[model samples]
Target: MSPSFRPRAPRPGPVKTQEELDEMVRRMKGEQKAPDNYRERSLKLHGWICAKCGREFDLANLHLLTVHHKDGNHNYNPPDGSNWENLCVYCHDDEHSRSILADYLRGDNRKK
Candidate 1:
């Protein structure tokens, strides 16, 4: 390398084109993965109930809800869907908060 050679500076302009935006979105979509049926069973445990408030929901409303793991481990999936539980939105929120808090206390849960 020549000592006199200098590296170029980076450009500072913002992205402005639809193609640029679409490319960015496409890159982000690559990182997402859909959950499987074992994961789907948690919604059934809620039994038309909202985890957040224990209110019974109609079929349509419950359909919009989701089953979640109390732990952050997506790999802790239960077999035969027996580990499933139904919880309305509110309860789900509380469960997540509690799980984080517990992990913090135990010192096993660190931000990855």
Candidate 2:
């Protein structure tokens, strides 16, 4: 004869009050660090022009400008802005596509 299987019930955790929940949320918010503003820093260092195409930009079209990491590492931002270049959307797309094509041709399918 086979024994019937039964699952164990979940253990109940201590319930937090509304004030406790709010305090926990407040503590989490306080512990969070401000996001890196590397784009603005790169723009300031490299100027408002595309590095590849030399396309100029103004306040109106500044949104189209993007910061490209030279080493392709987003987390490798330096305060000196050594690894960043300002590129327009078109040039940035071309730059990434070229790299992808190169990797494909070299049979290197690893994500960077």
How many residue pairs collide in each prediction? 10, 0
Candidate 2: clashing pairs of residues: none
Q: Show model 1 residue runs off by greater than 4 Å.
A: 1-35, 38-46, 51-53, 70-72, 75-79, 105-109
**Candidate 2, residues 1-112: lDDT per residue as tens digits?**
8986989777899988999999999999999998999999998999999999999999999999999999999999999999999999999999999999999999998976
lDDT of 2 at 48: 100
**Could you tell me the TM-score of candidate 1?**
0.45
Q: Which portions of model 2 show Cα errors greater than 4 Å?
A: 1-31, 110-112
For all predicted structures, in order, the TM-scores are 0.45, 0.70
**What lDDT tens digits, residue by residue, belong to model 1 across residues 24-99?**
8998898778557663465544466655666777766766566765555667776654445666667777787787
The per-model lDDT (C-alpha) reads 0.67, 0.96
Candidate 1: deviation at residue 60, Å? 3.7
The lDDT of model 1 is 0.67
Q: How close to the true structure is residue 17 of candidate 1, measured as C-alpha lDDT? A: 98
